[model samples]
Target: MARQPTSGHEGEAPQKLRTSRQVYDQIRWDPRLDPAAFVIGYETRESGAEEIGLPRFDPEGDIPWHRIRYIRQGTTTVWDRRSRVDLLEGKRSAPAPSAQCGLDARPVHRSALALIPPREAWAPIEAIRQAHDRHVERWMPHINLLYGFLPEAAFAEARGAIAAALRDVAPFEVTLDDVRRFQHRAGATVWLHPRSEPPGALEALQARLEALFPRCSEQSTVSAGGFTPHLSIAQLRGEDGEDGEALVAEWRRMLPITFQARAIHLLSRRGDEAFAIRHAVPLGEPSPEGGDR
Candidate 1:
């Protein structure tokens, strides 16, 4: 008989079959764009004005309000970021409560102490909400996205440092003086302006926060530079026109509105949900003698 054909495995140096290890062995972690990173920052709440045809998504109900931050982008994020942002606030047929972006009295004291005069603090929360309502009405949900990401440790430190810095300069009394406008990447926005001398308190806080969390720098997607810290009252979805200008002018005439700057809040936006309050850092503690500066 012809020599039995040798089994392919017999004497052949074992042919190395493709292995899972070989496939993933040299994969590199590219840091150019970290789509997997977690984002954290402050954002105002939205007043779900109209229910029209949109599904009712409750910002307060769906998302946690404090110590908030979530994955803004990446396949791994809990929900699709852009999709959630676009969802209308409520359903028209259902008439879900149209909640505005605002802080209730309870949260105000906890977040910022002696910073805003009680009356001053209360008024703007509503004022901002009204302004936001107008914008939303005209633009059908004018959402302003003020977002950034920080490593978890960096976030904790930065938030703490900023809070401490605010407390340090509390005596100066930063005031939110007027409404102003700026062109942002997403669109034009109307924000509250804080007028303070030496800008010392804000500056100090900025420096410290930046030193701790450099990832949110001006160059990053979550930029701190040119970020005039103001609660955004309204956002223009499209280009501003004479009509828009007229509308804004009408709003401007209504202004010269004022509020005391109390504290900076940390906010977060996950997948399809509107932004929620994460944590509120109190600016200063009032002592029996007066207020600690």
Candidate 2:
């Protein structure tokens, strides 16, 4: 039962549909939209439909989506997708803590997108980072793709899109071929440079994923230089560390930390804890919609 489009003098019309499948599909496929607040209803033999609010309904038959006759996100009657009616119309009184498409918004970075080397390869990198790298306790050995990623709750809905985007990307080998340093005003940081032969695959995959969450453009090498992917292993400062130049030479001598780049990991962490894997989107193979593994 499609409802007539409400008369609007300013914004666009809400997408019309008869069932709740469309609502779930949009939440599944579109990465930019989310339901910060919602209500779902079922058709009854009586006059009005049976309605229930979210985070409150019980799944009697384990088939809630099938019974959903109509849905509303905030104040907007969300029939098909949030993109259609959530244009400042679904404004709720109390906003979501980290709503992707909610009326209330805040910067969130409890999760990240990274290319993690296999557990087999963590030995040497961890060995070096344990002593010198200051961020060892906070992060695993990873090549950061998009830090300050989408809020943790959004990853479930975004997984479908993430898999679709990486469907064609074949697994490739990544090498930490050389040692480089970024000099600061006070201290200098040394890192291992990442290289993948026929070089653009890693960077291209990064760019593609970045497009999905257009807001996480913090690490984009737009003006500074091309994407210079690196793994931080050592730090040298004036207070109490090895010589930056000597450390670079030493790491270079022990250069070429290599591993197969099979899948990209979606990582998350609890309060003040080290980040851990949430999902691994395998290259060339589409990751199925499911829980973390």
Candidate 3:
């Protein structure tokens, strides 16, 4: 089906930048910006132009063997133009790591990106998860964006890049208005449904972060609906006889939970210990020396 050209009206979608040069130009065009100060982008294609202003991007264009397919800003290549070799798959890998782990979660899943609600918000949600969840001990009341994050060595260096990517993103408020669930092999896990005022804002934020670390995508690989921003509060796969559908229905009738998502928590744990926030990078700005973590 041919996609129709939309009438460029008030509610029309913003046009996507065609090339890396154009994207760079747009950023440069802004008067309040300094070019060299910013050295970040989650997309290798973001600077794939043959110099600065190549007329067009040719997928099959003549290329060089060492055409700068990757650039590591913080000792980590945020994006690689070429696909990675997934040994398990015996082929080039998907854009996101799909074979690393499933929804079952890895036993050694150490690092992660999450939106942890304030301590005040924790008490109530904590009570709920504790009563129903079989695997709710180590985690705080939070929503997972991307799990299985960078190693501890790269984490400190990577913080600056994460902060840079989020420099212009203002804090957003989220409402845990309802309850939801994901059915696993043996049972189901109930979770808090998070929604933003404008809608899709949370999803957009997740997408941007995922672009930065495509390999840390264990949560999204098995999710057929793509990245679902959710806070798993209750695990129903154990000896408990709680009904997932019933809990979701009951929570739906209750009052919704609200919190300010002012920052993205960089959580990590070693071995079997509980997860703790190593850093909480603030939205719209780089965090201070100590950080608010």
Candidate 4:
């Protein structure tokens, strides 16, 4: 018996299998390298009817996954997805690159209240952060006490309200004694987890802030769960496999650094602009008994 061949249409020509390859050059930053940095690239394809010429180095209009041989970030090959495919139906058009990763030249201003770590504790963490991506250094290590898209008009009122709410709270010590990993769909973040005895000061401060700024707490990602105090050390792409785990382990070994939280900072940024300290609200003075109450 003769076996019949499968066909989607009776008169259609057989789809020819082809190999497509593209190389993006001069890439300044790879998303895999720094989740914070913008994703940018150019592409060129080989063995296609569209055009066979010099490689295109223009900013990527879309991500040509089916045709991309590999994507290079800095001097590293960050991604590779290439395979043989039928080209008779023509190659699939690449979907437009996401606007989320696009670089915005204009600053977008915003404001928030946070507790930034002192330089003594931040220098080592900053080193690890920059090792992952130099750009991560732009953001200081901090625990957000309250953050939201606050307009300039409301900034003064918010700062005053926060100061009044925290006025009764005395300075306290926060011990970052362990390294933890915060996994997310976008990427994994290495963090310095703060530990304290029962009736934790960090939790207490967060509770007071939430009570004072219910709207901000409602809009926050960290507010859902009981407040977790931690400082971001580095952002990493999980695709890096053991490298990411190894980095987390290295940081874990450097546990137990303590610092006093003397003041809470009111930080602001315009739109996507870099954050700047707008006000520093000092905690209550220590009692005459030689200790904070």
Candidate 5:
């Protein structure tokens, strides 16, 4: 659960609350905007009140303020700059009515590339994912090949680039042989390791995509040099205790899950919203002489 912003009145004015450090770090700040200059506010009903906060803005500051028209769902908050522009330009005199917030909140689209396993594979994986991932219901089970923020304006160009990069790629098979754990500062993440020799077809596909659109790989924490092709099963927090380790061991025992990968899907969501498949590009059929790679 996410911490809701605290609200209080300074004299007759309502003060906007600063998000918690954890939530603040999760914010996908636009590269064009300065983090120091950005302040998030909720919308207030009162007209002609202070709706915007400046650099001196503080959640605990003694200042009279109104709300900004924005919606928060779960741990994610999203706001459109156009609303602020409208207010400033006198095109709008008051904040728009607040809408429902959370995962169910209206989606804003963004894009990524992933390899989706068939339903037979997804069924069991989804069960394990739900038990482990905090945001399991919001996302599907898939191997993320390339994930980046592709805005609608650049969607066509990005789609074209991805399609071209995968033009010669043939469909391949993946076998999840065992559970592997990667230790992180947060905790341990358990994943399904594909049974492939070093620098296999999956690696080759990722490399080709990275070469085509180098910028798409820029924001990823796992760099191309250290890329490991696997389907994430669960992200165990530090507090999950010995029970978490037991679960990982149990999953490892259920090894060698295999599936055929035929198409690369382009998935996207706005902010931290739920992802949906936007495009499916099929991998090239194997040549008669080569057979399935």
Candidate 6:
């Protein structure tokens, strides 16, 4: 029997086409997004090309990777300065990454991502969820620290709003001293947990975020009642709870990992469901010597 294509997908989906990253103006930055500066993901060059127009992007590069589910951005495509120019005049093809080095860079399309559910998304804020989740995952027992860094400044409004909310509580530092199992009725999660009481700063930060994006999933916010800072290891999809305990027993031996809290981020999802840093602000950086920005 032949497999019929889904509603939207027909014989073949349009290929994105191979183009120079530089010419395309579709750049990915590390940790933060600075419009004035763009970082190369991968570098490439082709023969006879005047200069390297786009940096090579090696999707297989050895960088710590995580996957994000996609959510919709507002309608209407807006272009940055460089992207505006590329669209007006058709894009030009440059040498491939291997053309310069000995590597062969192939064009690849990413898979569509599923979204995080609305309920579970915000449930992480509630204490009941945390307690049961910790029991189920096992890895939740050891979080001693919490750190959030925004990959872009656009989300500053969201992150800043959250931080302000935590102000009344006075922020506390966090330490995810170890990893533990996080379980819920839905499934098990391998996540990190805070070691000490986070400064009231965190509480206030959550308050602001909740107030600003009220419609967002409750799991998304960090309020006095909802915040438990931790690093995620993995999420389990299986229904068997017994396996969770065994996995935790084996994983607990690797305990006590620590990270610093420098900043928090507001991540935005693209049509493809890729998460991009939209905004970020430092948690511990001192203000300028003179005054404010």
Name the top TM-score candidate: 2
Candidate 6: lDDT of 197? 53
Candidate 1's residue-wise lDDT over 1-293, tens digit each?
Answer: 11122336667663332221111111111123342242322233443211110011112322333313222232332222222221111212332221222211011101111122334354534554565544322211111212233322233444555565555645345555666776643346666666665566555555455554443333123233444455456667555557667766665565554444455455444454443445446556432222222
TM-score for candidate 2, please give it.
0.62
TM-score for model 6? 0.36
> 72-138, model 4: which lDDT tens digit per residue?
3344334433322221121224422332211211111245567877788876777787776433624
Ranking by lDDT: 2, 3, 5, 4, 1, 6
lDDT of 3 at 199: 78
In candidate 2, how many Å is residue 10 off?
43
What's each prediction's TM-score?
0.43, 0.62, 0.60, 0.56, 0.57, 0.36
Model 2 residue runs over 4 Å out of place are 1-107, 221-223, 239-242, 289-291
After the best TM-score superposition of candidate 2, give how far the Cα of residue 41 lies from its true spot, in angstroms. Answer: 53
Which residue pairs clash within candidate 3?
A: 133-235
Q: How accurate is candidate 2 locally (lDDT)?
A: 0.65
**Model 1: how far is 8 from its true place, Å?**
26
> In terms of TM-score, which candidate is stronger, 4 or 6?
4
Question: Please, what are the lDDT tens digits per residue for candidate 5 over residues 1-293?
Answer: 22223335445543233323222223322333333444454443333223222222332222322334342333334333323211112223343322232211221224556777887877778878876776575567878776543444454455565666666787788889888876643357788988643338887887787676554452233333456777878888667789888998888777778888777776766565787776676777332222111
Candidate 1 similarity to native, TM-score: 0.43
Which candidate number maximizes lDDT?
A: 2
C-alpha lDDT of residue 188 in model 1:
63
The reply for model 5, stretches above 4 Å from the true place, is 1-110, 197-199, 219-225, 270-273, 285-293
Candidates 1 and 5, the one with greater TM-score: 5
Error of 5 at 2 (Å): 30
Per-candidate local distance difference test: 0.37, 0.65, 0.59, 0.53, 0.55, 0.34
By lDDT, the better pick of 2 and 6 is 2
* lDDT measured at residue 169 in model 2 versus the true structure, 0 to 100: 85
